[model samples]
Target: MLKHILISVISNDKPGVVEAIAETVSDNGGNWLESSLSQLAGKFAGVIRVSVSPEQQEQLQSALSQLIEHGIWIKTEHIDADSAPKSDTTNAYIHALGPDRSGIVRELSRALAQHKINMAYLETALTSMPYSGDPLFDATGQLELPEGVDIPQLHDILDEIANNLALDLSLSETPFE
Candidate 1:
């Protein structure tokens, strides 16, 4: 029988980091399933899901630990069962842009939480405006809305936040399948 393992790895950014990790998993009889990895601030960090036979689990762990000597840190968690996906049928895409500032995410997230909206995907970036060279903050995300929630009211709430924060905010409904 195979068991799923959730693993996180972080190390100084360099070539061959991913190749090394993939080799480690493959050498231990584990199949690399899904992962999200990025290089930020000179460090490579990622979380990956893999499946291996129950007997190979410990061996995989030991092999992964060998990476520590090469400046990579590993953490592993065993998943006993998988949870079903949420069935909220309504989805919305949200976009916001503003001059860089603190607390924008916190405030907007608080409003979404109050409306019981689950954020399905969120991506944020900070870059300088093309002509002005001023720092600009931009964010985009998908939100799942619970049934019977008033979307116009949610818009009003977001509008209030935009006014207060001096940002532009927009929300559009995603077509139902």
Candidate 2:
């Protein structure tokens, strides 16, 4: 039997961070399943899913823990496939941009919650606008809507938010690649 685990890690931004994680997994007879990683504010952070034989779970976890000595801190959670969240029936990619300001994420999340929509993943950043050098907010989200919420209705909600916040927003189906 294989034990599935989710690991989240954070460390100072540097090369070989990924290599360290990959090597640790490979050395433990684990299969590296899927991961999403990023660098921000000079820090490296990500979540990874891996699978290893039940017998190797403890040894593997201990080995991963040893990485803290090298400045990489990790947290692990063991999970089962059957216990995963229910799959969403509809998914869309949403992008938003406007002048940088507070409460943008809060408003967007509140709207989604009122409509019972789920945000699967979201990335947001503050950036500088070209020519003007104005502070701009950029955001992208992967949203999951359940069976009863139609896309057009969701669009209307987002449209209202954009108008109120002076933002440019767009939604589209996830691209195939």
Candidate 3:
């Protein structure tokens, strides 16, 4: 039987970090399943889900511990697929484009909270051209909405806020994959 584990790793940003971590999993006979990795504020952080045979679990844990000794901190937890959150839950995606400002995230998140929506993913970037004095921000947010909520109503609310904020905003239903 394959044991599934969710592992989160945090370490100083450096070359070969991913390779070192992957080597540990490969050496322990774990199958790398899925991962989301990024570098933020000079630190490399990632979350990976892997599957390994029961016999290899201890080896995997030991390998991860060794990484900690080398300055990488890892946290691992066994996951029960049966208890994992279902993605079939309905959701929506909201994308906003406008001048970079301070209140965008706060206002949008407050709206989502009012509707009890869950944020699944959010990415924001500032786009600037050489010699340009101001920068524009593009942000995308994926939110999980209640099953029976009217999507049109949500879109209308977002539209109103976007217009008031002078932002070009769009909302669409994002199918669970």
Candidate 4:
């Protein structure tokens, strides 16, 4: 039987950091599956999904723990079972952008929470506009709306928030692959 797990790593950024973590997983008979990694504020942060034989599960966990001595902090959660995508929900893609400022995420996330919307993943970044050189805030994420929530309802909520925050927001139902 195969065991699935999610591992989150945070450490000072440096060369060979990913290689070291990957090598440890390989040595422990773990198969790297999916990952989202990035360098932020001079640190390497990422979440990796991996699978291993049930027999090697403990060994893999132990090996991952030992990485802390090398300045790599890791937290692992063993998944009990694979989660099938939900059918009673509306999945959509969201893009939000505006001038870089504080409280954008808090406001938007708060609004989503108030409406019981589930955010699958959200990535935000600060970037400069090409010609203007002004700092801009960009966010992209996947949202799962409850069955009763329609696209128009979601758009209305997002539109209100965007107007208040002076953001350009877009939301579209995700076409199934």
Best by lDDT: 2
Candidate 1 lDDT, tens digit per residue, 36-131? 899888999999999999899999989998999888899999985364365755889999998889999999999999988888777788988889
Best-fitting candidate, measured by TM-score? 2
The residue pairs that clash in candidate 3, if any, are: none
Q: Show model 2 residue runs off by greater than 4 Å.
A: 175-177
Q: How far is candidate 3 from the true structure (C-alpha RMSD, Å)?
A: 3.0
lDDT, candidates in the order shown: 0.89, 0.91, 0.85, 0.89
lDDT (tens digit, per residue) of candidate 3 on 75-109:
99999746557755676787888877889888888
Q: Would you list the clashing residue pairs of candidate 1? A: none
For candidate 4, the lDDT comes to 0.89
Report the alpha-carbon TM-score of model 2 versus the true structure: 0.93
Per-residue CA lDDT of candidate 4, range 52-92, in tens?
99999999999999999999999999985566464687788
What digit string (tens of lDDT, one per residue) describes model 2 on residues 86-115? 765688888999998888999999999898
Provide the global lDDT of candidate 1 against the true structure.
0.89
How many residue pairs clash in all the candidates, one count each? Answer: 0, 0, 0, 0
Q: What stretches of model 4 exceed 4 Å from their correct place?
A: 84-87, 130-132, 174-177
Single out the weakest 10-residue window by summed lDDT for candidate 1.
80-89
RMSD of each predicted structure: 2.7, 1.8, 3.0, 2.4
